[model samples]
Target: MSTVIAFIVIFGALVFFHELGHLIFAKRAGILCREFAIGFGPKIFSYKKDETVYTIRLLPIGGFVRMAGEDPEMVELKPGYRVGLLFDENDKVNKIILNHKDKYPDALIIEVEAADIEHRLFIKGYVDGDEEVLKNFSISPKAVMVENGVETQLAPYDRQFASKTVGQRTLAIFAGPMMNFLLAIVVFIIIALFQGMPSNAPILGQLTPDGAALEAGLKEGDVVYTIEGAEISSWADIVEIIQKNPGKDIEFLVDRGGNTLEIPVTPEVQEIEGRKIGLIGVYSPVEKSPLKAFVYGFKETYMWTKEIIAAVGKLITGQFTIDALAGPVGIYESTSIVAESGFWYLMRWAAVLSINLGIMNLLPIPALDGGRLMFFALEAVRGKPVDRNKEGLVHFIGFALLMLLMLVVTWNDIQRFFL
Candidate 1:
């Protein structure tokens, strides 16, 4: 139950901040926001304020911003030329006509093609249906050769996206991730000022009898400097490095009597509640300070982000297995352990998680803020936006892929925990 609560708190805070970023920006930009919802599935509670509906749903996983006309497929376009084009059964070359060609001879011709085209031509020319002129002209021509095929109609609101200036659209898209970063910073500051900071001291305060440190000639008063040739600045660094190298022989540099000596220790394999961690019979000293606390908090947060990225890279390179990845269940268990340990420990974990959340959301993957930002960047570079349907389709596919990944990770977490 504690683990579940911790998970809820962590996930809810992160998601709220993420969606809040979009909501705030949308309102600031004068965009019509129809609804702001937290969670998915059926809405348990809802309220309307200032023409916006706010909803709380059954699940506490994440939230979303529902802006007006967010879905291009559902948008109704105003009546205009209403030019319709027909394609073959396979959506190949079909027929296209301009309803009011005489009144708007200079108007640009927009063509919807079945397959994606790399380069497009937008030139003013007459279509004689000649192969060479059609190829050279800047006009897009749908090959309307077949009948009884799917018909695609161009809506007047197709220009809605292209009509917005680059800056406005960019801001609208970037607002989500920018809010995540800001929320992370704010959470860090709050935790830093209120909860204080946790420290990992290298001094060997507690040692188990006949343990690795004792067996390796490490005394209680010695200050550890390095492990396995890697520089250890704090207790956190020592714990992280040692945890990853369980049951492995390691070299340690300790300071004793104003003399530095190297000690080789083979950590004992210890099972703690079905999980394996290297046991060196050592305990890190806990320290707290006002100035060092805040600085250290930020540094620790930054380091956590770097470490996660490094782990991901290593996993991709086959240095680690996918089983190393953790899902919500794993996080909940870890959070429970931290909470049980003490307040300082919980604060440290929270800080680390916050940083991780901020960095992960910035990845250039679909269904993430980074991916949307990438699309915006492409639009800015091309001086035109991608087709809304196409872009939406890509994001939909991405979201499906991400959900599949989550399911796999969750399954792994369950197997590791119970099986």
Candidate 2:
């Protein structure tokens, strides 16, 4: 149960931050965002703020930000059609009721002669079915239209994704992945601040309760100079010596505050990944430095990012198998193990996953942010945008293929873990 909660919280945080990046930049570019959602299925909760509907959906796997002009509008006004309009104090049309007109008895009934909701923001029609005299009314930029009891705000031509500069659009798309990386760095910083950074020196920091080290009267801050007469220079050397001599007694020469002492200790034998190893259960010493903590945050993030990119490069170059990929089930299993370790370990796992998510989204595959950026790049070069129909078709196919790949990966994970 703890594992499930940890997985949900970690996954939800990751998705939320990524989508938030899109929402922030989209609004900065004056684009109309219809919904900011953290899942894909039926809505569990929803609230509207600043003309954006924030929703939490049933599925916890993925999320999206729906921006105006990214897709076709669900409702449209046609010429020569009859509709009813409600006006605000400024006499601008605030609501255009397509049906259920009785709900707003004060709404002016008109037969539409022509309407330009996007740019000109005017609705020209004959009042109350009078066709002889056509009247034109201005529409407020924030006006909404109701169709079948659903209210949808009208997005002006200047307030759309495509209407913005190519640079602005590119930033809006790239910000999602960028925000993921930033989230990882912040998590690492928090971990470092709360728990000091680990060191690699041949020194002990904390000892496990009832472990061999504590049982042997070994105290924290003991610098192990030698184990069984073999010199221990670094923590790696100590690990190698102890792990090799499982269930065997070893002599440790330690310097504890300038006092050299000889201690006999036996490492407990443990089986890990089918290999027998020894453990005295001592943690490496760490230093608590605020400046170093901030530095470690970026350093650790960069290191992990570099390693992940190299692994992805191998996968792209056919050096790695497709089965190496992990899906939700595999992540859950890993999360359970990490959760058992402790809270800090779980946090580190979340940071690693965030970095991975950031890198994967930056891959130039269609239907992803990288794919949209590719189109924007072409537009910059060609002096015109790609045809919307063609681009939409490409994205549709790419999304379908991605879903199929996810299913395959998830099935593989289930078989590997459960069966």
Candidate 3:
């Protein structure tokens, strides 16, 4: 039950924020948004307001925004009307700009009153006398017609998407991922302010056999009062003292079971990631106050984000194994363990996971919000949108690869748990 609740809370918040991005940007772009729906498949419940239908679906996994003119088949156009045309769906009238074209057969006398701009559904008006007509369009009922013995149905909604200006459409695509990134930063800051942070303890908890602490005669439960004549309040202080005293003997004032004692110990040299630092084996006890908890929470959030990004980079560079990856089952089991630990631990983990979710969603992969933003950026740079069919195909390939990876990760999780 605890695991279920945690999953629901975490997934729900992450997904809601992601979709909320789309909803916000759609409204900002003055697009006719038909629906802002959370989750997928059949709607469980919904409400309509201000020309937008808000819905909760059965599956709590994903969401979408339905915008006007998003489909090409739906764009309606009238005959003999072409240049600088904008489709006004609300008005349902096509404005015609009459232009003459001299290239025509004498018998046909096809005066190009308006050129049917192939491959473009919408066009912008300029200062020139280039008149354009607006048309109504819809996408449905796929059928084929023969042009010069080649059968093709009107490529549905292909031209409609091409009509919008690069800047306007790029904003629509970028809004969602940008929102996720901002949410992560905000959550990290909040957690930093509220969560109990891990700090070093002044006293050594366990002295490993042959470790620096043991070699220095540091005993368990010995409260380190001073190092090198500097008063020690926390384990961090001890670390600072040792780090500065590498390969040097240090004087210590310790309180062991109410008895004060002074001892001299040589700091051991320890190499971490190719850098040598002084080491004294000790572990900090978890401590929390209301003020410290908040600060720790936010710090932990930021740290976790950095850790995940680093881990992903390592994985991509072959420094990490795919076996380290976790799927839904792994998360479920981990959440259960955290929930059982205690309230503060659970809260800390949740905050960390929230920040992780925010970062992961921002990765530029197809079938993800970030991936869509990449295409939008390209369109913005190239002065044109990508072919809708090609874009859809790329996303479809990404989705398939994601599914395969999920399956592998899920299998690994099951093996770790039940096996």
Candidate 4:
């Protein structure tokens, strides 16, 4: 149960930070973001704040920000179409009623001749069903239109994703993945600050209570020089020697305050990953430098980023099969395993996952941020935008393929872990 809660909190934080990046940059770019949603399908919870509705949906697969002008106009006003318009005190049309005109009895009924909601912001039509009486009414810049009993504010040309400069749009799309990387770095820094920077030195910091090391008189600050006549210069050396001789007595030559001491201890045998390993249960020394903590954060994040990139490169090169990929189920299983280790281990896992997510999202696969970036690059080269219909179709196909892939990966995970 604790592991489940940890997984949910970690996953939720990752999604929230990713979407928040898009929201921040989109607002700065003057785009009208109608909804900032987490997950897909039916809404489980939602709240409206300012210009955007924040929502959490049923599926926990992914999230998105719905920006205006990304889709076609919902309601179109054509010549000879009848509509009802409500006006503000300034005599500008504040609302256009597409349906349920009877609910707004005081609205002026008009047979639309022409309308330009984006740029000109005006409607010219015959008012009160009189064909001879032509009237032109200005629409408020913040005017809202009702369709099927729902009111949605109209998005002007300036407040749209497409209307922004290419640079702004690119940043808006890139920010989501960038924020994931930032989350990783921040989490790493937090871990470093709290736990100190991990060191590989063979010096002992703490010994497990009642464990072989503690029971055999091993003390903190004792630097192990050799184990059973074998040289130990690093923690890896100690681990290798100890793990190789489970349940066997080992001689430890240590330097405590420049005084040599020999301690004999029998390692407790423990099974890990289907193999028995010896455990003296001692922790390596840590560096408590505040500056080092910050440095470790960035260095750790960069290291994970490089490792993930290499793994992805291997995948593309066919060195690894699709079976290597893990979906939500696999992640949950990993989370459970890591959570059993300790809090710090779980945190480290989350940071690595965040970095992996950031790098994966940057892959130039359709329906991903990298895919949008690829389109933007082409637009810049061609000196014009791609045809909307063609681009939309490409994205639609890409999204379908991605969903199919996700389903396959999820099934594989379920079979591997459960069946």
Best-fitting candidate, scored by TM-score = 2
lDDT of 4 by residue, 1-419 (tens): 89789988889888889999999999999999999998989999999998899999998778999999998865888898888999999999999998889988998999999999998899999988577978999999889999887889999899989999889999999999999999999898989899888788888877888788999999988999999998888888888998999999999999999999999989999999999999988887887677888899999999999999999999999999999999999999999999998999999999999898888888888889999999999999999988888988988999999989989999999999999
Q: What is the C-alpha lDDT profile of model 2 across 1-419, one tens digit per residue?
A: 88899999999999999999999999999999999999989999999998999999999998999999888884667877778899999999999999989888999999888899999999999998566898999999999999888899999999989899999999999999999999999999999899889878899889999799999989999999999999999988988999999999999999999999999999999999999999998888887778988999999999999999999999989999879999999999999999999999999999999999999998888899888988999999999999989988888899999999999999999999999
Candidate 2: residue 168 Cα off by (Å)? 0.9
Between prediction 3 and prediction 4, the one with superior TM-score is 4
What C-alpha lDDT values do all the predictions have?
A: 0.65, 0.93, 0.64, 0.91
In model 4, the runs with Cα more than 4 Å from the true position are: 200-202, 208-212, 224-260, 265-280
Backbone clash count, each prediction separately? 6, 0, 26, 0
lDDT of 4 at 14: 89
User: How does candidate 3 fare on TM-score?
Assistant: 0.60
Shift in Å, residue 211, candidate 3: 19
**Which pairs clash inside model 1?**
93-143, 94-143, 94-144, 95-144, 123-138, 200-235
Candidates 1 and 4, the one with greater TM-score = 4
Ranking according to TM-score, highest score first: 2, 4, 3, 1
Q: What C-alpha lDDT, on a 0 to 100 scale, does residue 273 get in candidate 4?
A: 91
Error of 1 at 252 (Å): 18
Candidate 2 backbone collisions, by pair: none
